[model samples]
Target: MKKQKIFALILPVIALGGLLTLNALKADPPSKSKPAVAGLTVPTGFDINVIADKLGSARHLVITPQNDIYVHMASTRVSKGIVVLHEEGGKTTIKTSFANYGGTGIAMGGGYLYASDKSGVFRYKLDANNQVTNPENPDRIVTGLVSVDWHQPKAITLDNDGNVYVNIGAPSNICDELDKNRTGCPLLDSAAGIWQFRTDKLNQSYKEGVHYAWGLRNVVGITWNQQLNQLFVMQHGRDNLHQMHPKLFTEKQSAELPAECMFAIKKGDNAGWPYVYYDWQKQKNMLGPEYGGDGVKPADAKYINPVVGFPGHLAPDGLLFYTGNQFPERYKNGAFIAFHGSWNRAPEPQAGYFVVFQPFKNGKPDGKWEVFADGFAGTEELKAQGRAEHRPTGLAQGPDGSLYITDDNKGTIYKVTYKK
Candidate 1:
């Protein structure tokens, strides 16, 4: 037990060098009865394959025109912040070495590779081969964001117009008196929201960026909707509702209240976090526990409501507005969400380790969201110990219009293709 704890402490650094020596392992054939990709379900005529796996904490990913795939690592889960994978003859293999800072964001914009650790964002210039020119040293793009133990990942995205957006996740569960908010949570000033910066700018601090949106608790799932020319984000809802305010909320209510929300981000939007949360069942923004309100109370009228919402604690981590032509017409301009399941739903059994699709038309929600992909959890019923076989954390589209997903827990990457 002691050894296990210590090993977890230095997992990224210790396993990184050794893991790189591993030969590329082909994707296991999907099994209809198992958690395998074969077991997973997708739309008609769509197929999936695991290109790579056993990577330590692969987070977000980007596929360049050169067919090079760059995956960012979750801090403390992998040795390098960025891991490059190249494919030749249908098999993909990891590059030997790369960026050292741990992070959860990897994006390509303005001819540079952008990555982010817990508190900052950095970038590396790309060469003719679309490879980072200098892996050892990356230029600081945005600095001193925010990083407290919880929800610290600085997942980043870039718009087509060269603006960079960073998610500064709020660090606590509703910022109660017991947590970081004791003396007044200063994190609210620089965290729990989205900030916009110039992609070309270097050495810029948190204060330098424009606070584009607020009240977003933690937005690991963020993407620029190029089709609509807008930003979209999936905000992870707050937890610990019943534990903190047992008198007001039942365990079941806490498990399902405050639905994870998807927002069509417009400039100066405020979704209301820490002080309020969206109730999916109620279809209303309600006051947060810390702000003194019962579970049924309504929140401020000014706060924006999500375009779509899902059950609580599903932990949506990756968001992609599909503009690719490989999929059916129904999916065009629609959004795909990777739900990295969080087991707060306890005795009721955990849920979500799958991807959901939201159909959109004219840049707006046109119908109900539905499960587009499933079987990541590898189990019909969640175990009491609370763990999923694979949790999808990031999503990207390849040049050929194939969808790419990364599993942060196992460092797996899967490509989904559709054909008529």
Candidate 2:
């Protein structure tokens, strides 16, 4: 009977897949508003400004001490992958862009700007002014990382200890279909985890780097928390629960069961993907159906629980720990997450398309998370249709303690300031 039910759903699944792909590729109409803070919602005493716009697929960003901005472009208007900007007297202008390839991972450390394409990590020397001096002849630090068509972005961060961490996201969702016996997922050998590499090393490969952590399905938002002296990551939850395991989950249950989790990780922590998923409602890690259990069963004791679990499918693309003094004392040590929004959750009102703040106390989550800034999707109707005006993809902090957010949908760079 189970086999018959599964066989009956294959054609419908294929048709749905086609429709979803079409909807995803459909371009949204241009937004009409031109004001800096127009169509946005923020807390009192805070204001948002559009410092720059029309950048193509700006994913992650870094601000230098001089307040020079460097942004990674997954796609570009010109041939360059990194876009540089300079601000003076409250005005921002594009300085220049360089690099022959495009990607989503970029960081600055030790007078060098590090960037990654799909297959490798490269670094370029920076001048005294924090501008890339050798953009065309970057030194390849790490090479030969696995990258597929999806989940290919190697979101990166550097620690004060001269180490760089890169997230190699898992290609498969559940791996049930790939490893039919469910004994193990072969992809875990290289993907689905964070890998640590020395910032000073050159021409390093998978064998040269240490596998920092495993079992996280995919992590786009990653940071090294200086206060905690640990690595923190936001995991994107698995999708298609109802479509793949209809017997165990309803449509609503599928949309909301698994939680997008935040983990303050150590050297060998595992968050349990494919084998388990955190159910935010239960506040427990439930065994994945792919691993021969119903949704209610608890995951193995070896897997670590998340520091915080948010609603599923929020697609957290960026994470930044606030250490600036521009905001109130309450926000000094908190964390900000950029939700790129959700495409699934259909048959239910789609959600996300906002930034949220999670306060921290003594290097851990302190209180409930709150929406820090919202209305990126423009309207309820556009959000439901999965056509957003702007989707926040990256977060950065300026030298003067202002927060910067990047929109990948329409390429808008927002500067958020607090005036007390």
Q: Largest TM-score belongs to which candidate?
A: 2
lDDT of 1 by residue, 236-331 (tens): 998888888889988888878779999988999888877788989888888776776787779988899999989999999999988788888888
TM-score, structure 2 vs. true: 0.91
Q: What are the runs in model 2 whose C-alpha is more than 4 Å off?
A: 1-33, 77-79
Clash pairs detected, candidate 1: 30-38, 31-38
Q: Which candidate is the best by lDDT?
A: 2
Give the per-residue lDDT digits (tens) of candidate 2, residues 132-185.
Answer: 889779999989999897798899999998888999998888877779889999
lDDT of 1: 0.78
RMSD of 1: 7.1
* lDDT on C-alpha atoms for all candidate structures: 0.78, 0.84
